[model samples]
Target: MAVVVGSYSFLFVSTFVAALTYITYQLLSSYLHKWFAMKPVPGPEGTYLFLGDALMFKPKAGEFFRQIVEFTQEFRDLPLFKIWVGPVPFVALFHAETVEKILSNPVHLDKSFAYKFLHPWLGTGLLTSTGQKWRQRRKILTPTFHFSILTDFLLVMNEQAEILVEKLEKKAGKGSFNCFSDVTLCALDIICETAMGKKIHAQSDSESEYVKSVYRMSDIVSLRQRRPWFWPDFIYYYFGQGKEHDSTLKVLHSFTQKVIQERSESMSYGETGSDTNQGQKKRQAFLDMLLKTTDEDGNRLSHQDIQEEVDTFMFEGHDTTAAAMN
Candidate 1:
């Protein structure tokens, strides 16, 4: 019995070593192929072999985004340039013709590899989905964003904008202030209300757990994207900010799920009741439209589907719109 156990252990060890070696070889070969293929693309000089341009990426929160914009401007004359983030290659397109070529082709519709970091929080929502799923989802959601349908949410946007103006007015004549956070919070309020039909009041109550989780999650995801070592789930969770990431994700997903459940229940009740409230000019939210939306086969979106789209909107809408507004 002892001999048999020892033999089994030896075999397991040998097999594990062999498997690891094969995987390493395959990955290295793939990276080499990609590197050779992109050799024609111009890049910054003096990039490290293993680290690539990763060391140049600032570790601070917003610096990564700023540096990327700076790099693009620095190489604006080039049609496209390549940057190595560890083994991964990032090709930046500066020419309008090059970008137009990619966008005009349906074959190039898949999102970038960096978007994978958002899968934990967003699932396979419209932002991350590819192939047929993306086409189907886009078809179902196109009507929701139509001019007529979008007009319903104007009230929420205007209300949130007024609140933002009021807050900024108070700070007026006091001193120069960074209004980024204030503007982002107002955008958050508009997005939450229009997307979920739930008032989170982010401007008035930024300390709320849900609000904090949203910001924390964004920071954590951004950090992971810049740090190649954190690409692996095991490394990220055990060695990095795994616990905080998970806890923040729980808070975000919990809030979204709870809101979805409440909205679904209320929608059912509304369908059965009299159309009294329907007579009033009540603002219809994206969630309300999603509940009624159907696919080409007349199939309703699943609960998870609704949640993913809501979460996608919540993430995509606020900060981007705020950035533009600021």
Candidate 2:
């Protein structure tokens, strides 16, 4: 009787395992193979079930981006191509017409679903925002970037540029050191000053906690985006990526909150809700402008709203631009 019971249990477990495997394969293959057949543009062939090309980064983040670049060049003749980011298909276009068509369409203004991950970091600011709120926010923030305002920011830009050059001069002919790191620091410093009317001195203090967290958070977010298994919040939070993300958010948000509070307190003393320093006329920073400005309905933004925009611009302004320059 005991021998018979053991055999039955073994059979049941094996059957269950086989069924689960078969089901997963069928679901993965159905979409992948079907999409492969349907796509006009070429893409990675016979991808792994849920991983797509994500596994190619194994052993390390590896040369995954180089592989994509090579793939793009390999199919240079094609106007566009598809790439599966963990079963999610993205169409990459190289042709001017194809890019223009997508960009010019008002209907396609919605951000990609991947941007959902940014909600904790950026909130629903301009980059991730859409529909009515987006329209209203865009209207209010549009003039903040006007030519005259940007002209004021040029001095900040030049000052940061000079500091970068000074740093680079010391490294001249001192063997091969990473130039990307220095340039990124310079960009961060410039954006901090211009965006918040605060100087982070990131270039001088490269090991600052806030600066280090920014770089780490960038890596963490990129890694999370590439892996589909990490997409579900329950799984991500269970495995502790969520905690790391939250910790990084504290670093980023606290810094921005401090900047906003410092500026807010300064503005509180002024009847016009603006600040003056050392008896000299001070130019309004981005946060100051946002605080004084209102939406289409003439409603002043709440502290939460201002924080969202401040965090969004800080991330977009510094991180994206720095990475691009590097």
Candidate 3:
């Protein structure tokens, strides 16, 4: 009875809200058309809404960025032009100098609210952290990815690459296969091995549930960013809306916790051993660096901090590499 009542209430509220939005949109469009003086330039004719781009910006997944670049080129004749993705407004700059100025003025423009969608997964890690925290974390973590350290990681990368090549060889004479899935899996393996120092075979068909969860969580987060109907944090946490996101997070946390716990246990048992020295001296992965690091007060990072950073690396490293490969 409660479920039915709640469902009806939600339906009623959603319908009312949508009706109001339609009315407001019509009014706003009419007002802009009449009152605003648009300096016309050569481009496609239309206006866009702030959040309506998801509805009209139809480009293949991972190809939306390329489409934007193409659109910009097509309008290169104009110094500045407007394009609408639904009712949202976007001004494209054709001049290199203008873009350079915007890029250089880092302090003037803040990261877009779209970034907040990643906050739950990444926390205030280097990728999402700003100002001093970002600087300090970056400074501390930079050496971990240095050329020397990356050289050590190459063996892991090559091993994973070999696995992928073997898999592809099996399908060599086959008609066709999804190259995207293959690349995505390979990238996940690389990220897991390098970042966490764990040899997770996410490239395999029978990949860990944790690895699959990361991909699912990423998709949910990306969807929320593109079509933000409600506050994402609230929707993700409170509304039980993003069940996949929640489940993925739990699995990811469990995996990270297990890693940290095992590492901690090893450290505890070997009070003075080669394993401890090796962890201390040579080839520091991201997690190794995090384990060694201490905060301003000489306190170790909380478990939450380590988990967030590890998760961030997994998401950022895998997706960006996959997209680049594609």
Candidate 4:
């Protein structure tokens, strides 16, 4: 019994070490290859061998952004500049021509590596899918955004916009302040209503578990994106920010899944009450339209598929629109 236990322990340690060594070698090799390929690119000098520019980055949001701005200004003359965040290489394009070259290329449709951090929260929805999956999803989702359908969303947009204006008007005569959060919550409310047929009223109640989970999950994903050491699933989930991430993810997924289940059941029973009023058509949310959509093969999307798209819309629409507005 003692010999068997010792053998198992030795085997476990051996396997662990082998995995660690393999990972280290792969990272080192990738760094060396990128270092050589991008050697001509101008970047900050005197970076550490392994740590690179990561040590210079601040954990604070404003400070981190300031550092990035400084870097861009320093390398403004160059079309592009490279930086190493640990073993990962990042190349920032400064010129429109340089950016257009990549953006116009069909081969460059795949999202960057950082988007993988969003997979836990969003799955491979339209925002993150690539290759044939992306094409298929785009086709499946294109009709959902038809002008008529978007017109229905106008009701939601107009209502949320009024609420936002009222909230801002309350602070109009007061001292100067940031309106970003207020705008973001308004956007969240609009997206929630338009996407899921549910009213989270994020502008009114931002303390709700779903609302808080959305922001917390974004923070966790952003932090992991910045830290290369936390890229591995085992390291991230077991060692760094794992418990908080899991809890936040559970809240988000549960809310989305519950809504999806309810919407599906509602559609199955033909319980839509659009015609109950006098000449006022009920606005179908994105979830409502998705429930009735079938793919090219006449097969309906599975529950998981619908959830992915709904969550993707929620993730993609809210923050970006808020940022643009603010």
Pairs that collide in candidate 4 are none
User: How much is the lDDT of residue 293 in candidate 2?
Assistant: 84
Write down the TM-score of every candidate.
Answer: 0.91, 0.83, 0.72, 0.88
**What tens digits encode model 4's per-residue C-alpha lDDT throughout 101-199?**
998888987898989888878899999989998998899889888998888778778888999999999999899989989999999999998888899
Cα lDDT of model 1 by residue, 1-326, tens digit: 99999999999999999999999999889888988898888887767766778878888777877877888888888888888887788998868899998888889878888899999999999999999999999989988898986776776788889999999999999999999999999999989988888889899999999999999999999888878888889988889998899999999999999988877898888842111244666666888889888888998999899999999999998978989988
Worst 10 residues of 1 by lDDT: 271-280
Report every candidate's CA lDDT. 0.87, 0.81, 0.70, 0.85
lDDT of 1: 0.87
Question: Judged by lDDT relative to the true structure, which candidate is superior, 3 or 4?
Answer: 4
Residue 209 local lDDT, model 1 = 95
Model 2 lDDT per residue over 263-301, tens place: 888788873222335775566788889879887778889
- Candidate 3 lDDT score relative to the true structure: 0.70
The alpha-carbon deviation from the true structure for residue 53 of candidate 2, after best TM-score superposition, in angstroms, is 2.4
Cα deviation in Å at residue 157, candidate 1?
Answer: 1.3
The most accurate candidate by lDDT is 1
